[model samples]
Every structure is written in C-alpha cells, then in structure tokens.
Target: MLHSIRAIVNGSTNFILTKMFDENLGFKEALLLAQQLGFAESNPTLDVEGFDALNKWTIFLCHAYGIVTTPDQILFTGIQNIHKSDALVAKARGQQIRLVAQAKKLVDGGVAAFVLPQFVLADNPLSFVKNEYNGVVIESGFADQQFFYGKGAGSFPTASAVLSDLSALRYGYKYEYKKLYHHEPNQLNDDIYLRVYVSFTDVKNIPTEDFEWIEQWHAQEDRKYLSGVIALKKLKTTIWWKENGTSLILEPDPIIENIEVRKLKKKAWNWLDYCRINLI
Candidate 1:
C-alpha cells in the first residue's frame, strides 16, 4: 500500500496496479492493504460497508486535530438498508436523501464520527450534491470553516486523494500532531424519505376516517404512479395501515420505524381503493 501511495505521490507515474487475493474483493482488500502499509494502523469496519467516507473523516481528524483513532471508535452507518419507499417519501416532501458522513471536534478536546442519511435543506451546501457526489466541511477556531466538495469515491478519485497525500509527504511538510481522545457521539437529527407501492386491488377496504386523515396529509402529485399523489408530513405518525387485503396511504406526524412505514403504506392503499369505489 505504501508503494501504491508513493506511486500516486510521484504524479508522473501512471497505471498503478494493486492485486488482492481475498475471496471477497470488496473494500476489505483496500482496508487490509491500507493497514498493512501503515496508512492506517488498525482494522476499520466501515470500509467493508462501503462507508469509506468515515475512513476519510479519520484522516481529516488526524490532519486537523492530530489524533489517531481506531475505526471502531467512530460511529458508522450505511445506506444499504434504505428502501425505495424512503426516497419517494422524501420526494413527496420536496426533499432528497443523502448519505452523509461527518466528523467534528468537540469543545472538550475530542472528535465525533458518524454516517447516516440526511435530508439536505435547500439552503444547505450538501443539498447541491447529486448522484454520487461527496462533500466535506471542517470548522476550527483559526480557519473558521473550510469546505471540500468532490467525488467522495471511485477509483480515480481515490487515486487522486492518495496522490495528494503522497505529494505532501514527499515535500517534507511538517504537520502538528496530537493524540486522539475518546469523544461523545454527535447528536444527529435528519429527515428521511420513503417510497411505497401497493396493489390497486388492495386499497378499497380502509375506514373513511382514515382516508380523511390521508387527504389532510396529501402534499403533491406523484409522476411515477397514476393512482396516488405524493404526500408529506412529519415522520412521527402511523399514517398507513392494512386491513382485509386493502392498503392505505398517509403521512406520519413524526419519525417512525421503517416497519411501521411499511404497514402505513399497506393501509394507505386500502384507503385509496375505498375512495375510488364510493365516488363511482
């Protein structure tokens, strides 16, 4: 890995090759190589979950705070569990879901590491990132705040970042170093969007009162489906319920579990069907 890092730093060198013998050729290979080559001194977990953003955050912590922390000490989350329903819900609320990984220095000489889904507000810098784009923000007393935005992952991007590190190392840039201290977890609160679908036949048996509730929460029309419009509300209520093979759609008043979200979708479908029949 050091050789690879060195090659990247050289800049003049092109076509660096890395070979992995492991059966799972995913991020484990990269993580292992990084550790073996001293780029990282300990095992990292998020590397396997495709959350390399956390790894990058650690590197930033090292540079900014002069601290070295184990991967386990960082709180990591992944987007593997995000469902289509969630995305749809976000769209209904005039928002989008982003996989955000962040680290920050606390007041007590510690750092915070975490990764999860975030609903970027229109004015937030991260809201501009689309597709696979990535962004980073750093704040400190001297620098006030700094922002780094670019491709967070991909072979070429990784290579570029490695190359930059190599150039700095080769130039004999002296960096101030500080030991890592255990820090409290970051208190994260971000909205999420979910998209749900229900069979047309299963949306006719829910109660009228439930349908009224859904109508009140309705936000906008959805272009993807003909039967339903996009709806928005807080993520805290049980807006959907299922009954007698019918499903209903409704918006939650506050944040709820994904399972509850599923159940709500089922109920919403049922409610829609009931309205269709009564109108007919």
Candidate 2:
C-alpha cells in the first residue's frame, strides 16, 4: 500500500533469530542449521550482517513512498552479535528477537528507516513470524493496520516468485509508480531517537554520555545490559556499538516522541542528582 509505514522483508535473519529464541540455539549454530536447510547461503554475510534486509528496505522505500535510497544511506545492524544469553533474557521477559526493516513517515514529512534486531513483545505479530516466514505490518492512517505473511525464502518461494512475475508480464501488468510520479517523496531523516538495549562485557564499550535517557540497567558477573534512548544520528556516526563483544537491539516500539525524550532527560538528570547525594 502507498501509506505503508513499515515492512520486515527478510527471512534468513528471521529464521536464525527464531532458532535462537525458540530452540535456544546460539547464533552460529542456528546459522549453520539455516544454511543446511537452504534458508541461508554459504556466505551469510549479506543476510546475517543486515545488508540483505537493508537492500530490501530500500526497495520498499522506493515502491511504497517513492523515496529512493541505498543501503549505505541508512543505519542498519544485524543479528550476528546476538548470544544465547541475550535470547534467555528476552525469553524471560516474554519477548522475541527479530530483524526488522521498518520506516515511518514523520510529522515533518520526512522518513526514517532502519534494519536492526528488535525485541518483539508477545502480543506483536512479529513474535509469531518464525522459521523462514516473513511478515509485514503496514500501519496506514486511513485504513488502520494490515498484515501480510508468507514464505520469504528457499527454492520454492523463489521459483513461485519468478513464475508470478512471468505471469504478470504476460498479462501486461505494470507498476504505476504513482507515489513517485504524483507525490513528493519524503527525505530520510536521522534526527530522531530510539530506545535501545545494549548488552556488553564492559561498560567502557558503551557511550553512556551520549544517551538522552537511560530507563533501566543490570549487571551480572559475565555481562551487563542497559536500556536507554539514543539519537539515530549518533548510532549512524559512531563505531562503538560494533566493538568488544557488544550487542545492541531495539526495544519493541523503539521510536519515541521529542517531548518524551525531554522528559526522560530530566528524569535521568534527577537520577544522577540522587546518585551524587547518596540518596539511594
């Protein structure tokens, strides 16, 4: 649909995450299983590294909103860093991890897109999208929410898609590109903020000072987890998140409002104030 807000289009990463979440398999183990089952490739860099989803998101951008963008132009992260511990924590919290490629039309007529592993709440439809199934949830202002799901990978789906394309061509079908020709495409915006979860072996690897807000945190003997709000721009520009065995994932419904950002910043400041006074 023309007003589609978000689309999760990749199945390889989804299958891996599904295995990790449902079967408690580690990343590499799940990946190997996927490769064995034809869900993934011998070289899974494109799928597990988020490039495949990034490319698919760009195509969705062009088709849905007439916005032309490349994978390099957007911020993306993959499931490679996900560990069994992360999956355990998520399962304990009744959430599932999924690689989601989503874009939203902002109030300022700009668009923001990301391909990243996200925590899906139990009630979210994405939580049920397991194995090699792909699911897309499109939120439209006028039509409410619509969801589509199907096999997104493997030889059968690929062959079916090719045959469908041939059939469409034989029937003289064509994409109107109405959004591109008749409507003004929105520009990609990186000025927004997202609530994120980061698990790391060392706090030094995390840029805590850059956080607009931190809602929760925990430290165990082996690992530490922090939940915070950060600028999308910072994520795009910084390399800290990719280093030293750090894993970052977005919370379910990661986007937050500017007013909420300000309020959380104030709360974080108050928390620091209490910490400074030893009032805990």
Please tell me which predicted candidate would have the highest TM-score against the true structure.
Answer: 2
> Model 2 Cα displacement at 178 (Å)?
1.4
Clash-forming residue pairs, model 2: none
Question: lDDT tens digits, residues 126-155, model 1?
Answer: 555543345555555666555666544445
> Candidate 2 lDDT (Cα, whole model)?
0.85
Best by lDDT: 2
What TM-score against the true fold does each predicted structure earn? 0.42, 0.93
All candidates: CA RMSD (Å) = 14.3, 2.0
Which regions in candidate 1 have their CA more than 4 angstroms from the true location? Answer: 1-50, 104-110, 139-146, 154-156, 165-175, 178-280
| Candidate 1 C-alpha RMSD relative to the actual structure | 14.3
